[model samples]
Target chain A: MSSREIDRIDGSALPLRGDNIDTDRIIPARFLKAITFEGLGDHVFEDDRAAMADHPFSNPAYRQARIILTNANFVSGSSREHAPQALNRWGIHACVGESFSEIFRGNSLAIGLPCVTMSAADMGPLMDLVERAPDTSLTLSLSDRTVTVDGQRISIAVDAAVRDAFLAGTWDATGLLLDDFEVVRGVASRVPYIRGF
Target chain B: MGKTLLKKVWDLHTVRPLSTGQTQLFIGLHLIHEVTTPQAFDMLRARGIGVAFPERTFGTTDHIIPTLDQTRPFQDTLAEAMLSALERNCAEYNIPLWNLDSENQGIVHVIGPELGLTQPGMTIACGDSHTSTHGALGAVAFGIGTSQVRDVLASQSLAFEPLKVRRIAVNGTLGNGVFAKDVILEIIHRLGVQGGVGHAYEYGGTAVDAMSIEERLTMCNMSIAGGARVGYVNPDQTTFDYLRGRRFAPQGDAFDRAVSWWRSIASDADADYDDVVEIAAAEIEPRVTWGINPGQSVGVSERIPATGDAGTNGAVAEALDFMGLVGGAPIMGTRIDVAFVGSCTNSRLSDLREAARIAKGRRVASHVKALVVPGSRAVLAAAEREGLDQVFREAGFEWRGAGCSRCLAMNPDRLEGNQLCASSSNRNFKGRQGSPTGRTLLMSPAMVAAAALAGEVVDVRDAL
Candidate 1:
């Protein structure tokens, strides 16, 4: 997957609301054995998907849902890139939660999976709406910092600099770092221990 | 107000501020292991990038290394390939690797401090989450993902957002048999898993100051479990004494100069902090995780939390169903099928010695399968030198070589289906110990030894 500027996502919401939904629960360690993240979506919440037939991901209506609404600290725990990869591959374009883990949010942003957070009070009504109308298409507009559903808007906030990356289409740190190769080399050359390779 | 040690280190290493609200900080030491670096090196190769500062990077085989019969052409093909990929990548890039054959080889975290490569006031990064283990020596260290690892390898720097420093002070004295592992577990229990979000934990206070380096390392190693990116202790005379004679530490006059600088970087008496939390060390008991996550813990003497007491009723019921545990019951005496004592968390020399002391005259239960895997090759040798290995072996535990054995189950050491293991590792996530249905209960090394002897989770205090 490559980084793309994500300004807006419009889709029916699939709500897996809870606190501290850690990466291990998102994609367990056993699924990370693959050489690459290929086919990880098949195992996303594998145990949960197996045990709870009623898990939202297994619901026929939410199968094509592109936005996941969840509670605080979503994607917390181990620094496994597979967590975001699984969400991305499973057709989640964005995650709207009360909070997200630092590393998990970083990984998601790198993969173009926008993880956005709102206040607990704001999240309660939003989750209520999503749960009430699972098929209602919600529009998350990064440019305006709001999520709109059926002409009604719920204003949201993302880190200003992170929003700038999305709006400017420069979220790829690797690409930018790669462009400044000479400067990196200059800094590396001056380090006391790094005289030569 | 004076700056905290974390701020001082960040100020020292800042290269530039990015438009993305992150600072590019020069990494003093870049450590890598077999599991996370292969794909990172592949990213570099794809980008036609060589390691810009190869000398700052060190490689080791840990995650996938076998603890028994580690011969050429490993029995597990994927494990051999991963190790080979690391060897080939390091060789091609001129990065020094402490291969399995090298005496310097061990768990990446253990080897760094023991070899004296990890020092005070440096920024250390590794692809593994437990890299915070190095912070016990007064450095600012954290784990990074594979992409960040690639960035560090190619640019010798990382773009990182600043973290608020939360000073967590544990005062008073700990009870007997309550180790550093219990202290951290108690902290996580009180703070909850997500309480440390967007903050770096600076451990302090009388209890923290009195801990040995090994005990401190154990505390910092699990800071991630509390959702903190970094955990550290201030450098002091104890830190200097620990590094004085190590192979990579500065020698003679250079050592004195280094010590002078290190002393300057310790948190000032009136340093500023974003938040302060105080805990009474006396309140902590030997902690045992009763649920899937590290934060889901109870004291050995306490009852499992009622399902209603858990924040979400669904999560509580789900965890109980998954772990085959009943709510409101005592945490001790939970039967276990396996016992493992090894990980970057609790696999140092002192940890092994403590476990061996508990196992000396006892025998493992007939129904239990127990193993002792040291953190590094050096730790393995040190344990054998003191006959700790013999003590464990005579008590029916298999003494294996050094590696991250049974930690994440990336190696041959793993649990079978539905088997519950009392492990000294950091994580207790479902399926973390190999089998999809396997269960893991996180505890201290001596607790694991006692569990092995009893064929169930038992109080180490009783054995003591």
Candidate 2:
């Protein structure tokens, strides 16, 4: 089994100021019609970018941002992995938010994108740092459990299991799951419903 | 303390503990659809991996199928390409698929239960977030991303972290015209959208227990909207009766045995829950979302909350700006141009019947464009058998074929620019209904029907 360890991401951050930023707003359903996820990044937040004159994705200063900073319940609607796939393809390596929906976090982790949590109070300065200095570099270190920007450290929280998965390069769960084919069959056999009782 | 149903089911599905502090949980059933599976199949092929248990997986075309014309070669070539890819992948992997022409075809969640494939105590995974709909049948169901879909296809299992169980007990009886949709909306409104994170909502108590199987499905269907990836009610006689003779359900003596096992999986009366929330069912009213998320809802008679509402945290302001609604105004009479009553959330026969009842003797307002789409072909056939379709057509509401028509708007049924629609489907997110500028007001199917006739938001109870 081969997987890439994603313990740290260092780059400029894009700040999307909103709570409950849903997947529909991230990558609209119309864009999901394609058979492949290719070119989805071009359409990420397509509507939002068009509608909001100051939307971060449309801002030229944040064009090459590799990290995203956002508010609570980020990516709340739809479990389409395409939302994260679009962000990943858009060069987002990590997201720091007040909170994230369960499915969105899982989807991001599966693709080796670390979604970390920070307090709203902590996020305020980080978001300001990114917005005030668009070119400022932010470093998210899973090993240290902190995001460092302009020599200031902000404590962040990642689910322990998720942190371990990223650190161990087991974030690609298919190989980990496929390694236990025999045990899976054994469990399936024991379930009465699977065996027609 | 006794174990909750989630605990029992999670233990039953556990294969082994992984070093990443997760359990390799076996999936009893895996559902796929065209939108999310193509990439997963690609991943499997790239890895030289074959489907581990093809029989346990099921595929369908819903998101991209054009509802109006069920013809070969869809008008949208991109949609056609997606459907073709799903067909080719399913055939290559030996996975059973319910294609557009198949009687079994519909939304993946709808068909899974209608065919009796979703059962009690099973762990169900699907690419669509509405997979929680199967939890109505007492299954431990949750939506997954494509990578996890690939994981299940490769090993019939996933590395899962167990969820804490929260028992949301809705006691008392529902008031007149207060449907399951209202009950869940009230729950989401009471609890913030992110309240159920890291937990599985165990819906129960008098109100939830008294709900029919279809009603329970509607309630569970929006669990994801409330931030719970998994939600379920313990299987009861109601569940067994609903599944009794359906296609994939156990038969004869086996069914009797299965019921016993199903009953055993119910959360114990003295079950230990991470938390408990009690709601008075009578307090729920027909709900209407006035904002961009499901949780931004108000009772039919209530006014929209102003930005000054203490807990809104500027969301109220953002929603008002986006929806073009004034704060403190009554949500009762907001004008609407469209009405859609179909989705995995509320496109069943019962939902159709409810909407048809409101449309039976009334004409849709001249300015309103309305349509009814069934959850499944089976639902459509049953509605036709009951002449519910005729009632809708006579009322000037178009009766269309099954597929997830307007909800998410992957198909041709979509909102035009800047039109406000009263929708029965879940999620009122910006751009959710095809048009970026179009606005959606989430409500029950009956409410959507009432809105259609009134050309504005109105209480369904008035018609009832």
True contacts kept of 2: 0.95
iRMSD (Å), candidate 2 = 0.8
DockQ of each: 0.40, 0.91
| Backbone Cα, N, C clashes tallied per candidate | 1, 0
Q: List the residue pairs that clash in candidate 2.
A: none
Candidate 1 per-residue lDDT, tens place, A85-138, comes to 898899999998988888888777766778888788878887787778788899
At residue B28, what lDDT does model 1 achieve? 87
| B268-291 per-residue lDDT for model 1 (tens digits) | 989999999999989889999988
What residue runs in model 2 are displaced by over 4 Å at the alpha carbon?
none
Cα deviation of A3 in candidate 1 (Å)? Answer: 5.6
Q: Write the per-residue lDDT of candidate 2 for residues B1-464, one digit (tens) a residue.
A: 99999999999999999999999898999999999989999999999999999999999888987878978888899999999999999999999999987999998888999999999999999998989999999999989989989999999998888799999999999988899999999999888789888899999999999999999999999998899999999999999999999999999999999999999999999999999999999888999999999999999999999999877668899899999999999999999999999999999999999999999988999999998999899999999999999999999999998899899899899899999999999999998999999999999999999999999999899999
Classify candidate 2 by CAPRI docking class.
Answer: high
lDDT of each: 0.86, 0.92
Clashing pairs in 1: B106-B376
Error of 1 at B389 (Å): 0.7
Give the CA lDDT, 0 to 100, for residue B187 in model 1: 94
